[model samples]
Target: MRLDGTVALVTGASSGIGAAASVSLARQGAAVAVVARRRERLDELAARIRGDGGDVLVIEADITQEAQAVEAVERTASELGRIDTLVNNAGVMLLGPAAGAPMTEWQRMVEINVLGLLYCAHAALPYLLKAAGAGPRHVADMVNVSSVAGRVPRSGSSVYNLTKHGVGAFSEALRQEVGQKHVRISLVEPGAVETELAGHNRPEVLETIRARFGGIERMQPEDIADAITYIVTRPRHVAVNELLIRPTEQE
Candidate 1:
């Protein structure tokens, strides 16, 4: 939990909160593996981290694919030698009324947001357990990123809410199962951070939602990154199980 010399694998590291969290973890002395579908973006993030004298690896693969997710964790352990932390930050939000929403978008959200997190967690668990008992930190940690929608669903966000809620539930169960093994599972629920998540929406709807956040001082991605850092850097006996962060001005 100290984060010094820890090996962290962060999914969705191409941009937004994941990218920010990777940088934050790297700054704390963890060797970070950045995973995402965009090779170029991953490279960019890796370069930035390296420029700051942080150890980093760029693994370009779509986490929704089971094989890629497994390969990603394997490669991280092979290259970095061990895995102490996992940040399951890869997710999608295609918000619309379910009745008229495109089936493809719904499936895509489920695949990337729900199944993707599971794939990464499945692959990372073994290494996490190994590190938990062997490393100086004495505990391994998994941080699953959820949304405020996980707790409170809105009319236009049914599927997005479902995926996030599932993440919250999964984190709770995993925590109960893994806590005895010295592996900590935590969930970070963020409310309306200013990020590229909304760009996945249909153009018109994206514009409308953009305007809604445009007036309010929404949280930055780094804000969520800071929350993640706080959780992972705690002492071994202190497991911050769940954290909900929202911008002060936002409802």
Candidate 2:
């Protein structure tokens, strides 16, 4: 599982799951490039990783933009050598009713959760493939972070559901396409992690969410990071195709 000499690029790395995953991968000996829009947060994360003797690069770019996404990937490969792993973790969840819901919220979700992930994956695929062929590990990993809502639909989260479902579908198809080349593509669906995702919702929606599962313990970002690390560190012949992670009491 040691990833010494490998290079990885993680999106949405300003905080939460992306941040934790970047640290985890670095700890496992991968030089990591952390991508997000918040430059200050990214600088803070880079400092922390560097303090621990890990190599990191901070790229402050809005991945929703295709050109920025492509540049992010190209710069990472140029600066850190080939990208052996890509974590498509940039996403937003604006949960609300479909009827009378702010169209902007839906649009934002599609832009970040769907288009952002796609752009990063598309740009990184060639580098990942090249890495799979040359590395001592003989494999590359692309881990897409979705949500449990990707698997199950709820009334207030219709569009959120749509985006996550699309992630799952795309991951499966891409996995099939690249499996023979040893570029392992995986989907990670999480439930009720304590992150800033819920803060993006409306006050009314937050109240309803609190009324339902607020008492239940939510998983930490590091918990999901652990799942991601496990997926990428597997042996060359192994592929952890999909993992649905939830707190013990999330049901």
lDDT of each: 0.92, 0.95
Full-model lDDT, candidate 1? 0.92
Highest lDDT model number: 2
lDDT of 1 by residue, 61-141 (tens): 999899999999999999999999999999988887778778999899899989999999999999999999997698999
- For model 1 the local lDDT of residue 132 reads 94
Task: Give the range of the ten consecutive residues with the poorest summed lDDT in model 2.
Answer: 205-214
Q: Any runs in candidate 1 off by more than 4 Å, and if so which?
A: none
Clashing pairs in 1: none
- Count of backbone collisions in candidate 1: 0
TM-score, model 1 to reference: 0.97
Q: Tell me the alpha-carbon RMSD of every candidate.
A: 1.0, 0.7
Query: How many steric clashes between backbone atoms does each model show?
Result: 0, 0
